[model samples]
Target: MFDTMTMTKVVGGLCGTFLVFLLGGWAGDIIYAGGGGHGDHAQAYVIEVASADDAGEVVEEVDFSEIMATASAADGEGLWRNCRSCHSLEPGVNSTGPSLYGIVGRTVGSEDGFNYSGALVAVADVWDADHLNGFLENPKGYAPGTAMGYNGMRKIEDRANLIAYLDSLDD
Candidate 1:
C-alpha cells in the first residue's frame, strides 16, 4: 500500500532537484552572456615623446664603409699573426682552435668536423662585422665561457683590419 505522505515527499524532492538544475543553468547562461563584466581590451602604458632639444644632442654618423673599403687584407693578415698560435686561416685545417678561413660571415661556432666549446656553440648565429668586432673586443664577454684563450683586441681599428683580412679569404 503506497502512503500518500511518502509519495508527496518523493515528488517534492524531485521537483526541488529539477528546480536547482534549471536555476543553475539559467545563472550560468546569464553569467556567460554578461561578458564577465570586464573591459573588451587591456589598458597599456603611454610612452611620452621627448623634444629634440630635451633629448641629447644628435651625433653625426660616421661612415665605416669607406674605412672598411680601403682596409688592406695584408694588414689584417699581419694582425692575424696573433691568432696563428691557436687557429689556422686555411680551409680544411683545424688547429688548437677551429679554422678561421672564410669566418667573417660564417656562424659563431660553425667549423665542420671540429669540437667546439659548448659556450661558443650556444651562439651559432651568423657572424658579421659588428659581431666579429664585439667578439674580438672581448671573446669571453661576447660568448661567455668560450674556450678561445686569446685576450680581446683593445682597439676597434685592429678589429676592423682583422675583419677586412678575414673577408678576403672567402671565394
Candidate 2:
C-alpha cells in the first residue's frame, strides 16, 4: 500500500526532526555551559545567609521559668488549638497522640492503653517542667525515633502556657 516516495519522505521527516533536536541540544549546551566568557573562573554572585549566631540573636531567648511564672492558662487554652488535632485533653482518650490530661507531672510513656515509641521511654521518666520545656521545644530532637509527628512548639512562652493549661486540667 506504501510507495518509495512516501518511504523516502518519512525517512527525511525523521532525519529532519533528529537534526532539529541535535541543534537545539547544542544551542542549549552553548547557552548554559558557562560559554558566556565565565570559563572556569570564580562565581560572580555570592549568596550571603545570616550566621547561626545572628539568627540566634534575632530570636530573643525566652526563659521558661519566667514565662511559666506568669503563664496564663487562658492563653495556653488558645494555643492548645494547635495540639488539639493530634491530642485530646480528656483523660484516657488518645487521639493521634496520647491524651495530654495530667501530662505535666505524669510519667512519660505511662499512658494506659496507648502505645509509645521506645525512644520516649528511654529518654524521659517524667514530664517535669524542664523536661517538658525541652521536649516541647523539639520533640524529635529530645527523643529521636519518637512517633509524635509534632514539629514542636518553637516559642518557650507558648510551651510554658500550654503546659500550664494542661496542668490546670487535672486540678
Candidate 3:
C-alpha cells in the first residue's frame, strides 16, 4: 500500500508543474503580445513597400519591336526551362498546359486537345507578337481568370526571347 507522503509528493509535484506552465505562458504573452492598444499608438516602424505602379515608373518600358529585334533564341532556350514543366514545345503534345509549339502566331485557346479556360479565348483571337508580348509579360493581367498559373516574365527581353524560341520551334 502507498503511504500518504508519497501521495502528497505526487500531488505537490503536479501542482508545481502546472504553476510553472501557467507563469511561462503569462511571460510569453507579455513578451510577444505586441502592445495591446486599441489603435491609440502609432507603429514603432513604418515599412515602405514600393507599389507596383511606382516600380513600373522606375523601369523604363521597352517596346516589343525593340526586344524582338535583339532577342536571342539561345537565351530563350534556357528560359524555357521554367516552361518545360507545364508545357510541351512539341506539336500535339499537351502537358499541364497546352503544347506551346508554334504559339507565337497561333490562335489563342486553339490547341487541338488541351482544355483551355474561357478567359484566354475571350481575350484575343490570335497570339500575335504584341499580344504574346503582353500575355507573356503577365498572363493573369492580360487575361484575367486564365487558368495558366505563370506569374509572367517581368523583363520584356525575356518575353521576346521566349517568343523567338517558340517561333523557331515550328520552323
Predicted candidate 1 versus true structure: per-residue lDDT over 5-79, tens digit per residue: 999999999999999999999888778776557546655777789987887787666455655666777888889
TM-score of each: 0.59, 0.70, 0.65
Worst ten-residue run, lDDT, model 1?
34-43
User: Candidate 3's residue-wise lDDT over 1-171, tens digit each?
Assistant: 679999999999999999999999987876678533434578799999988777755556666798799889998899999899999988999999999999987888899999998998888899888998888888999999999999998888888888888888886
For residues 1-171, could you state the per-residue lDDT of candidate 2 as single tens digits? 689999999999999999999999988888899765667888789999988677754556766788889988899999999899988988999988899999988998999889888899887789888898898889899999998888999778888888888989996
Please say which candidate is ahead in lDDT: 1 or 3.
3
Error of 1 at 14 (Å): 99
Residue clash pairs of candidate 1:
none
Specify the poorest-scoring 10-residue window by lDDT in model 3: 31-40
Q: Give the TM-score of candidate 2.
A: 0.70
Q: lDDT of model 2 at residue 134?
A: 90
Could you list the CA RMSD of all candidates, in the order they appear?
13.0, 4.0, 6.1
